[model samples]
Target: MRYRHILAACVCVTLATAWHSKATDDIAELPPMGELSRAIGPMVETMLNGGVAVGLAIEDVSGAGMYSHRADEPFVLASNTKLFTTAAAAVSLPPDYRWRTEARWEDGSLWIIGHGDATFHIIDGYSYPDHFLDQVAEALEARRIDAVDQLVIDARYFDAAYQHPDWPRNQLRRRYSAPVSGLPYARGLVRIRRGRSSVYSTTGDPIATVTNFLVRGLRKRGVKVERARRAGIREVQPPEFTSICRHECPWPLEKVLRETNAESDNYLAEHLFKTLGAEFHGRGSFDGAAEAVRVALDAAGASLDGFTQLDGSGLARAENGGNRASAATVTSLLRAMSKHPRGGPFLRSLAISGRRGTLAHRLDKGPMTGAIHAKTGWIRGSLALSGYMRRDEDRVVVFSILVNYNAPHTYDRRQVVLSFQEELLRAVWDHLDAVDTGWEPPPPALVQALEPGRPAN
Candidate 1:
């Protein structure tokens, strides 16, 4: 009857803590980092031994920065780049935005046109694999149309770049690197679970596949589709077709964004990225998306002084000069999102530590379980964690801990660096989760002491 995904998200979110608006007063009450510093001295030393490049920043949403260690230096963001893209999209796109597609009948042809919707079967899925197509067939049946001479899958709505140029050509077939199209189903990937197993990944051209799938569906529904093919960008115009049925994504922008951040979905991220450009620049392409993102950040008052964006999914790596940003830039964006009208959903979208998404297993559970809501990113040489840590009930703090372990994979330092990050946050959450009674600005000695190889003073 409808499509259903066995692993659909079963999540609960109550949105973000209210924005902390008393900036000046909060600064006066800023917490001291002395305790956090002491707790991380050994951890940092060990990571340094393993050849790690650390960039950390922790800031009070209602106040100012509490501690910083080379926080201004830009580092490869990995999937952390998703934070910026999603944040920008939150601000620029309408709060209630939803993607839509239409099926049309014209000149004895059936045409399916898409406007950037990849959300299918991931949430509350339809029972049938392609319920939307079935619905189209039923609609045609209701209209007493028995057959169509041709079926066309039109994906020209989005540019045919298909894949990001900066992405490694070898990894194009990986599920994480699934190609994007104007109209996508199941994030443009077909699951290959075997004998009750849960894992799956294989790539196929979505437009071509859907066209054929729909043809079979129509044939099964007592309609004959003589031919099926993908439509080019300039193939069909408004006057050339008559709308049959239109379908809108069941989820709104907020919910889609939750999936974007919670699942770290590259396909959703890229489509939304291009949608931004299409909305602002009248066409969906990498360049347009980049410019639109900048505008959104500018509108949010988030600074990207040293940030460089190449693609939406942060799939770009150091070898090809991927997305880069400073810890300060990350915190700045988080802080702005806290006060934004859409901040609640934005915060709620982040993956929870020891609870769900990428961090469901990390942070070691216990009091820290479900308490830390953040996004985790990892690639060959880089790892990033950025988001909010609830101070109590109505308050929160923002932080970004980015590490680069590219020196040598001979003995992967992932465990060591990961331990450093976990213990550091554990200390912040358990011991120094509040402001210092009497605090002062970070001194020159402290800043100098934190310079990578240098010992803490």
Candidate 2:
């Protein structure tokens, strides 16, 4: 309740990160931000009795009039932590990076080396990885590779620390908390069928699972393997190995980001975090990944000053091991991404409120319907809605609403917190200081100001 940077609602936008639009960049000059502070100040204060640990921040691409309340204080980020991981990835890594898994014909043996491809599974009964393996099988068939001494599966690109240390032991078996690995299948989770429905659960060992999958794939295609096993990290293969086929996941990093942010897949999130570590720091462990995230975000203009990231996914408790960031810091990343030339994809990666992913059903009813594109985060005692709200190509804003509620974690309080978030967003739309298109209603204050001879300020 201590911070405020208010700006009146004025226009709509095509892209959420289209802040660099020169045509309407001067709209910030129309209204004083103080007007926004006065409008939403009381509305936000009344929620103290229902949910107290409220944090909020809203800003346009120019970083103007970001309504900030408790913006500087750190709050628990649940799945909202994916914002940091994905943003860092978007800015720091190669834009066209893909997850590569290769099969090689080595000295009298076949070898498969995996480099953190999470989409290595069949979808709608079509397996892309399997097809690539069939290509290898065809090459083997032509070479008269009747028998091989070993079919070695090597996932040494990532260290063997598949599970994060901070994850809850009780929840370890759940699909959401599935472990990360250098080589993953269906993002380290397996489908379990029950009656007419099914659920995903953690596969005990990702490497072994992938190994079995590849072994079956080859054997089914008539490539005989006498022994199949994992290759050691330090054991170097001879230089005589010929590249049979190098299969990369289709639009792999794009798919990973979508699954990580939109689907909120913790396994893929962790895979990305550790993979960043491997790519940037020469070590793929959790610490190395943490270092990589810090470096990446810092380079991209979002300082991790007060941010504490225990894991890539915000499954770890805030006070326990989960990541924490201030409302100001979350907005800092939003503002930074808005200016980043390549940040469009990261902004677009979020779920549309009324239409898609985790936020599909939440804000569908009112003016905010299909307007909010964001990541939703929820743990037992915390809830967050952070991302962009774009109505047209003129008025795009980035925001973060984080709340650490009182105990019991009841459904009613959850609704209260979310209601607060929607109202806060509605308030932002009200004050964004842009001209209306006549079909959609402007903010109440703007409507009043537009009446008769009143001037907008």
Instruction: Give the winner by lDDT.
Output: 2
What stretches of model 2 exceed 4 Å from their correct place? 1-35, 191-200, 318-321, 434-457
lDDT of each: 0.72, 0.72
For candidate 1, lDDT tens digit of each residue in 251-334? 899888888897898888998888888888777888788888988888888888888887888997646456999999899988
Q: State the lDDT of candidate 2 residue by residue for 140-215, as single tens digits.
A: 8888886778988888888897777677778887878887887777667777899999988888888888878777
TM-scores vs. true structure, each candidate: 0.82, 0.82
Clashing pairs in 1: 2-126, 2-127, 2-128, 3-126, 3-127, 3-128, 31-435, 31-436
